[model samples]
Target: MRLVTQQRALALTDRTSSRLASLQTLRSQIEHSGNLSPAAFKNQAEILLAFFPEIESIEWAPKIKSGSLDSFERRLQQTQAKTTQLTLSDSESSGIAFHLPIEYQHRHKHLPLQHPPGFDLIREAQWRDAIRSAIDRNMITSTRRYLAFAEDHPTDLIRLFLPVFQADTSQNQLRGLLSLELNVKRFIEQATQSNLAQAVPFEVYDNEDHNKIPLYHWPPAEIFSGLDSPLEHKTVVLPFADHEWTLVNVATPAFIQKYQNRLPIWLFVASLLCTIAVYVIVRITQSLAERLHEESNDRCWQLEQSNKALSNKMIEKGTFENALRESQDRLHDFIRISDDYFWELDTNHHFTYVSKQIVQFTGFPPTAMIGSSFLDMLHEEDSNSFRQALEKAIPKKRKIAIELRCKGHHNHWRWEKINVRPMFSTEGHCIGFRGISQDITDTKDELELLPETEPLLANESYGSAQQAINSVADQITSDRRFAQKLENFIHRHKATLDKTREAFFREALPEVAHELAALHEDAAEIGADKISELAGELKESHYKQAHREEQERLIEQLESHLEPMMDNINQSLHRQNPGSAGQKQA
Candidate 1:
C-alpha cells in the first residue's frame, strides 16, 4: 500500500538516463579484465533510482527504457573514446571524473596517490568532490526561495554531477546552480552512510543574467501536490534500517476520469475463467476418488481369498493327522489279538519295530525284542535257513514262511512260524517287508510226546529182549558157582570134626591117669577127682552108655555151629537164582 501511494507523489526526471546508467555500468565491467554478471549492476540501479521518488512518497521503482539504454551505452563509449583521443591541444592538465574527497592544495594530483599510476583516480575524485560541494551549498541557498510551497512538509534532497567551463582557464571549475524544492511525508532517518553512498550529483544552474549556461550535474528534488494516481506503485529498500512505510495521499479528480467506464468489462472476463478452472479441478478430483475406492475393494477381496485358503489348508492337515493316528491304533490291536509278534525292517534288515505281542509270548516286554535282529535271536543252526526263506520271498514277492526256534527270554528256545512277505511301493520297488512270528511251542511239544511207531518201535523191542536173555544167563552161571561152594564147605567141616575128637580122647586119659597115681601115692588122702568119679564105674554097661551119650552131645554142638553158615550161603544162592527177575529189577 505504501508503494502504491508513493507512485503518485514521485515522478521520473528521465527513464532514459537511469536505463543508460545500468547499461553503462555493465558495459564498463565487460570491457575490463574482470568477471561480470547482471547482479553487478545493483549500484547502478540504486544511483539511477533516486530520480523516480522522494523519501516519504512511499512507492519507488526504476522506470528503465531498454531501447534507450542500449543506444546511450553505445553512444557513450564512442563519445568518451573520441573525447580522450589525446589530441595535440590536450595538455598534461587533463580533466577526469571521480567520486572521492579532494586534496585541498594540489591543483591536479591528489597527495595520497595510493592507486596505480595509469589511473590517478584520487586526484580526479578531489576535483569532482570540491566542485559538487560548492554547487550543493549554493543550490540549497537558492531552494529557500521556494520555502512557501513546503511550509507543512519535510524537504526532499537529491544530487547529480556534470562538467562546466569557465572563461578564465581551459579547464572545468566551479559554476552557479539550478535548484528545485519539494516536501515529503517523512524522512527515512535510519538510512546509513552506505545506503546513501551513490553519488547523486547536484544540478548547477546558469545565473539569472544568462551570461553563462552552467551544467546541472546534480539533481534537485521536485514535489507535486494532489499526487493521487490511477494505478501506480512504489518500493523503498534502503540499507541499515528495519522496514517502514507510508502511503501517499492525493486528490481523486484524475482517477475518476480515467477508469470511469472500463471496470465491469474486465471483471466479467476474469469471473468466466475462474468458473471453468473450478469445474475442471472438481472433475479430476472425482476421478481420483473413484480409483481409490476400486483399489480398496481389490485389497479386501485378496484378504478374503487368503483367509479361505489358510482355513482349508488347516482342515486338510487336521484330517490327515487324525487318520494316521487311527491306522496306528488298529495295527497295534491286530498284533495283540493274533498271539504273534510283528516286525518292520529297513532295506539293510535292521529291525525297526518289535510289537508288544513279542512280550506276551517270550515272557518279556516289547523292549526285549527291540534292537534284536532276526538271525541274532534265532538258534545258531536256523540262521542259514532263515536267510534262504528271505531270498525266496524277495524274488517271487510271495510270503516267505519258515519254522525256526528263537532264543526265548526265559533262557529257552521257542518255536515260531515266521511269515515274511515282500513289500513294494506303488512304483514296484522293494523298500522293506512286514513279518509276523507266531508262537508254535505247543505244537512242537505235542509232536515230541506222540508215540514212536514203525522203525522206532521195532528197534526198541529187539534191543529190550536181547538185554533180558543176557541178564538171565549170567544169573544162572552165578547160582551154580554158589551151590558148589556150599558142598566143599561141608566136606572141610567133616574132616575138622574127626581130628578134634581124637585129640580130645588122647589128652583126657593121661590127665586122669596122673591124677590116680597121685592119689595112691598119698595112701589115705581124699581126692576131688576120685570122689566125683562116676559112682566109680559100679556097672560097666552103665559106664559105656554114658560115654556114648556124651559123644553124641558134642556131635550135636558141632552141627549147630555149621548150620548158620550153610543157611547164609543158601540165601545168597537164592538171591542169585535165574528166576528172580523181580529182585534184579529192585
Candidate 2:
C-alpha cells in the first residue's frame, strides 16, 4: 500500500519536473536568439499550454532600465492604444532592489480576461520572491500558492519563473523573465487521473509553509466524510522545483475490503488439521515404521539421483532465457534512440508494436497506433501498392523494401521508406512482419527542387501559376463595381478623342503614351510578350496622326490584352511568395 502511494506521488512530481524542463528549454532558446517579439513569444507559450493542460497562463516581462522606462511606456501605449503605466506598489515584497513589470501574456481560454499590461511584479510577495530567486541563482524557481486576480473573483494558482539572460553579455545581464501560472486543482486532477488514484483517497500539504496548509485534497472532504475509516494510511514526500509536498494516501473502505489478504488465517487452520491427522497416522503406523524404514531409504536414494539430473536441465534453461532477455532489451534500446521507428504487424496487417520515436514523425503516440491497420495510415494512392507488395513477399517469407506516402501530422502526406522481413514460427510458417520506417519527406521535397528534373519542376510551376491566375480572374469577375468604373473611364476618353482630335492629341496624347510605355515594360517583365508588343505599338502610334484608324485598332487590341496581362503579373507575384500573395492583393 505504501509503495502504491509513493508511486503516485513520484508520477506527479515527474510530470511537474517535465513541464519545468520544457519551460527552461524555451527560455534558453529565447535567450540565445537575443530577441523575443510578443507575437513569437505568445505563439510559443500557446503551443506549450496546448500540450500541458495543467498550465493556466504564460507571461513574459522584459527587463526595463530606469533610463528607458519612459520610452518603453510610450511604445506600450502605442501598441495597446491606451494610457499605460508601469505601476509599483509601496511595499518592497521582492528582495531585489529593482522591480520588474509584466509586458506580454498568453493565457488559456478558461482563464478570466487578462489585466492590461504594465503589472508590477513586486506587488506580490510570492511572485517577487520567485523572480528574485530565478535571477540570482540563474535557475528556474516556483512561487508559493497565491490567489490570482480574475474577472469575477480570485483563483488559487502557483507560478514558475525562468529568467532569460542576454546573449554575450557580461555578468549574464537579465533580459526578461518567463513565467507559467498553473491552477492547483487542475494540476492535481491531471496528475492523479489513474484508476489507482480513485481507490486511494489522498491529500497534499505544502511542507515549506509554517502553517502546513493543504494544497489539494482528493475525493473532496464532503465525499470522504461519508466513507468508513480507512484500513491503512501511507505518507510520501514529493519534491518539486524548490518546494516539498507531503502526500498522504488512505485506502477507501471498499478498496480495503476487496483486496484484504486472508492467507494467514487459512494457513493456520490448515496447519492445525494437518497436525491432528499426523498424530493419528503416527499411532497407527508405529508398528509398521520398522518395516517401512528400509524401503524408504532405498526410495530416497533413487529420488536424489533424479533431482540431480533435473537441476542440471534447469540451469541450462535459465542461461538460455537470460541471454534471450538481454538481446531483446538491447534491440528495444536501439529502437528507442534511433532516428527511424521500429514496428511490428500481425498477419492481419494491424500494428502489434511501435517504438516511441514514431511520435516524432507521425505526431501520434505508440498506444494510439497499436491495433490500428497499417494500410489505414498510408496515402490512398500508395495503399494498394503496399498491400500488393506485402502479399507477394509474405508468401515467400522474403524481405521487402518500399517507399510510400503516409498520412502524417495535420493529415499531411509524407514519404516514408519502409523495410520489413516476415517473421516465422518454429515450424517455419509465416506469422507476422517486423520493420523500420524512415521519414523521407524532406528528401522527397529536396529531390523535387533539384534543377535536373526540369520537366517535373516546370509542370509544378505552371500549375501554381495557373491557379494564381484563376484566383485573380474569379475576383475580377465578382467585383461589379470595378468593372463599372473601368467602363466609365473608357467611355469618357473615347468621347474626348472624337470631339476634338487636335486638342486630344496635344493634352491626352502624352499622358496616354506615358501610361502605354509603363504598361509595355510591366507586361514584358511578366512574360506577356503579346501584350507588350501591342502596348509598344500604341505608344509609337500616338506620335503619328496619319494612322488614325490604326490608332483605334491598337487601342482595341490593348484593351483586349490588358486583363490577361494583369492576371499574368498577379500570377508572377504569387509565384515569388505564395504565403503573402493574398495580403499583397488586398
TM-scores for all candidates? 0.26, 0.39
Clashes of each: 24, 0
Candidate 1 TM-score, C-alpha based = 0.26
Put down candidate 2 lDDT per residue, 339-412, tens digits, no spaces: 99989999898999998888988899999999999999998899999888888776544567899998888988
| Candidate 2 lDDT for residue 313 | 86
Cα shift from native, residue 366, model 2 (Å):
81
Q: Pick by lDDT: which candidate is best?
A: 2
lDDT of 1: 0.40
What overall lDDT goes with each candidate model?
Answer: 0.40, 0.65
lDDT of 1 by residue, 421-537 (tens): 877888777787688888899999988888776233313533443343444345446666534544344333433434434433343423333332332232122222332232123
Q: Give the 10-residue window scoring lowest on summed lDDT in candidate 2.
A: 82-91
